[model samples]
Target: MIVDSPKIKNLIMSYLEEKKGKPFELAVDAGCGTGRSTRTLAPYFQKVVGIDVSESQLSVARKCTSHENISYQISPAEELPLEDASVDLINAGLAAHWFNPEKFGQEAARVLKHGGCLALYCFSLVFEIEYKDKSEELTAAFNEALLILLEFHKKVVCEVKAMYQELFSAIPFKDKQRISGICEVFPLTVPEIMSFLQAICSYKEFLEQDKDKATAFLQDLEKRFLDILGESASDALGFHVYYFCLLASKS
Candidate 1:
């Protein structure tokens, strides 16, 4: 159950709304795993399609989705199973880092109507836990925990760290813009934050390499957070995460 940042979604929609000349008809959620990002498009578009390469993920997405106008399909991001000049908006939420940028760009260019928008967005994994007085210590501890898993990061991970600067260049759209330093704050408990961290791909890779070491590292991270707070481990804390978006429009 991956939950996308609502503020980021709202930001993307706002930009698209500002730039569009006509009503939004069809929106595509490329690499829409579990349909979380797909569901967000329902209210704005008459039709929304969630595309993914994994049936297993689409199965969960289907089960979770209740919007009748929203549908799911199994397809790669690079090869969208959609007609030419059909989609008004194509959004890939956090999932674009795993895609073949060149092919995906060509497909996006083919499917997007004239003046259609393609928005790719992702949040910084390196975020700080905002606690009361010990905010500095807590943030440092949390970031340090993430350092243990850096060895497992894939090459695509670097694109995210650079805030999609390279991917923005690869988007094949003549009219495009890169927006960065968009910050959003969320309230989450230490355990909830841990759950989010564990869901990251690098963490899974770290676990595969050494399960016992990974488990120990996870446990230590929680303990460190709790010690810094000097309170209940389940106590909610503020998470200040920064996000970046690359917006491209077809000419």
Candidate 2:
């Protein structure tokens, strides 16, 4: 989802361009789950390193990624392996909510060179759908169904839903800023949308709590979405997802 997003890529590029300095040599993707964000950084930086605490995720990333300038490592966000003042950019995509913000901030400050950039971003679920006459009703139903799933969300998910207010506040950088209401429209099928929701960690945890209820909720959601589309499960649907970003620069 993060890699296939053009808006996100443009946003990252625009942020880097706004800094307007020497080209970045090394970019660090902190808490990079499967190297999606790491690959996104490859074209912009001389070398991109993806760091995650999960060995399984790193193994998957190594297997899936073919970029010569990108590498995957097993490391925690609070204690990165990079040298101080070595990295030119540090990005945490959809993963900052899980980090100890203060420790990660200190580590980021240590690793990033003067005038380096730091970006933390995450996107919400498909909050709105663009169909014919049923857009409003479908969106309302989607929100209602999402509220049920959110009941089992982890604390970190709540932090993200709050637009990373706490995480932004923890960043010690004086040049920090927040950008919100960045929306992306994706053309996907009803089943595809449901699959995206199932991929979410919070939804997975919710499924673990009550598999029957979770299954029913997903089934109902799929049905509702399809019904609004007036087409089969394979029919294409347009979904709008909203995102927020926190950007900072080392002085």
TM-score top scorer: 1
| Best-performing candidate as measured by lDDT | 1
TM-score of each: 0.95, 0.93
**Residue-by-residue lDDT tens digits, candidate 2, 1-251:** 32436676677678776773668799999989888788878888899999999999998899889899998888999999989999888988888888998998899889988888898988855479766677797778778877777777758667977888888888888999998888888886677778878977878998998999889989988887777666544656668888888999888
Clashes of 1: 0
CA displacement after TM-score superposition, residue 108 of candidate 1 (Å): 0.5
lDDT by residue (1-64, candidate 1, tens digit) is 2367777788778878777755899999999988888998899999999999999999999999
- CA lDDT scores, all candidates in order: 0.85, 0.82
In candidate 1, position 134 carries an lDDT of 76
Error of 2 at 98 (Å): 0.2
What lDDT, from 0 to 1, does candidate 2 have?
A: 0.82
Measured over all alpha carbons after superposition, the RMSD of each candidate to the real structure, in angstroms, is 1.5, 1.8
